[model samples]
Target: MDMRAPEQKYDPYRNYTRQQWSKLRDDMPMALNADEIAALRSMHDRLDLREVEEIYLPLSRLLSMYVGAHQRLYIAQRKFLHIEDRKMPYIIGVAGSVAVGKSTTARVLQALLARWSPKPKVDLVTTDGFLFPNAVLERNGIMQKKGFPESYDLPLLLQFLSDIKAGRTNVRAPVYSHLTYDIVPDRFVEIDQPDILIVEGVNVLQAGRLPRDGKAVPVVSDFFDFSVYIDADEPVLREWYVKRFLALRDTAFHDPRSYFNRYALLSDEEATATALAIWERTNLANLEDNILPTRPRATLILKKGADHVIENVALRRL
Candidate 1:
């Protein structure tokens, strides 16, 4: 088989094996230590110093270059217009399946980007915050579809993005609690202007609905200067989801306030069975019907193996 992740005559991506992609790091030094990388990783995800140097280091360098270019463009635009307009944040969208470690990737990137020269302030935001409250979902009869695109408030999300791109300050977004598994009422996070903003979630790359009249309707990805998608086979993702769920039963689910606290009382076998049922009924359906379809929209793809390590990368041809 070819070393490429996928083979297609008309493919828009240039694929690279792990070894091949690691070479792209060139002489760049590692920016993170083992402890920092550990803290940045998701609860059930695997990330170490070597993973950072081999995978994320090169990625961070490439993103810094992109950010620098965007900065330069702003200066040129100012010169051309003979006016100093406010600098716009370079938004990056990170999208993938629920258990694919998009949160880990986002946090790691934010940390590394903030360390770049000129010292940019990077803000990391997840679309989980845009998810409708449980009350709203239940009222709308779509509570089971929580991670589906419909469970999100697209207008509010889009408006928040619009405000950030327009250099607005103190722009507030809703807050979500994974433990409670719902949106927190009257809670919000203010996003001031930042050099780069990473928007990560399972649905960030999804497009908004279009009207038949052909009027301009801005989708979530329309605001992204760059986008990344984490990819893995369905079996791998299912296994990861099940593993994470079982681990959570021993950890997060033990919290009395956790929405999944009931799972903590189940036997290991029972927990596993309950997890598989949820995966099949909710997560799997969302992945197939919503998330996976947006994969091609990403600017870069990180393809992971069964071990949760990035096996290869596919950079969309510019």
Candidate 2:
């Protein structure tokens, strides 16, 4: 008998494919019943039951397990330290391209997670809340780079998450205004101790690589209990961005209070062209340079098909 070395199999961080995902659906929890499904149905007109069942069902199930495990670990650590009763929020980071529907996913997860027995109240906070105000972006000459990591107040964001994860009470985050395209003055959202906090944004998983005299700063994913990256082909994302821009231009941009009021009058073709230009200049650039590279860092990866439905899910196995 010939003796040979055992071959090392590839260990992909994204471990699940479409077929394996179907198999996992049998064991995942069902948090949303018919009526709740009906409500979310109308809200997310783009998705249907099958997509939710196969994709989000498994994803939420994974998150629930993560939440439970984190709680157990917290308790165990505290007990070992001889501390009294305590709790910490399990932080989830959701990252994706601008119009890839990560915000909708975060909202849906928040609603579903809150319905769990003993109902752990889930708080959804977008990194948009940490975006520098328009005046500051303008001063820094980065108004066009709004979704880039540099556009946000990184220290403030890190401190806010540090507070939440450290179990701080009455922690408040600045509110952002889509209509005005800036951080609202004085307005804020106070997040008390919660079972889970989902933070969604474009560059949440991006590592800060600024040459700090000579070393790299800590990456954002360092704090995430679980992270998800929403993904789709570049062309599909471009089409969605253009479509969303046209829809928003026809609806929201026409309002007198709208910061994009000037774009309201663009003809369909012109609007599409402008949207493509913006994508080419800003969003696509950010996706290529910052967002896409961080995909491997996520614990879960939701891969959307050309039709904009989640066709596959990839889980990073333990």
Number of clashes recorded per candidate: 0, 0
lDDT string, candidate 2, 1-318, tens digits? 436545455556655676678667676676767666656542223665666677777677777777888888888898899998558788889999988888878877887788777888899898898999999999999999989988989989888988887888989999998888879999999999988889999999997667859764656677789998999999999988888888889888999888888899999999999999999999999999999999988888988887777777877878
For lDDT, the strongest prediction is 1
Error of 1 at 233 (Å): 0.6
Q: What Cα-based lDDT does every candidate model obtain? A: 0.91, 0.83
> lDDT at 122 for candidate 1?
96
Q: What C-alpha lDDT, on a 0 to 100 scale, does residue 118 get in candidate 2?
A: 84
RMSD of 1: 3.0
Error of 2 at 292 (Å): 0.5
TM-score for each predicted model, relative to the true structure: 0.96, 0.91
Tens digits of per-residue lDDT for model 1 on 278-317? 9999999999999999999999999999988999999998
TM-score quality measure for candidate 1: 0.96
Once fitted onto the true fold, the runs of candidate 1 whose alpha carbons sit more than 4 angstroms away are: 1-8
* Strongest candidate by TM-score: 1
Model 2 residue 30 lDDT score: 69
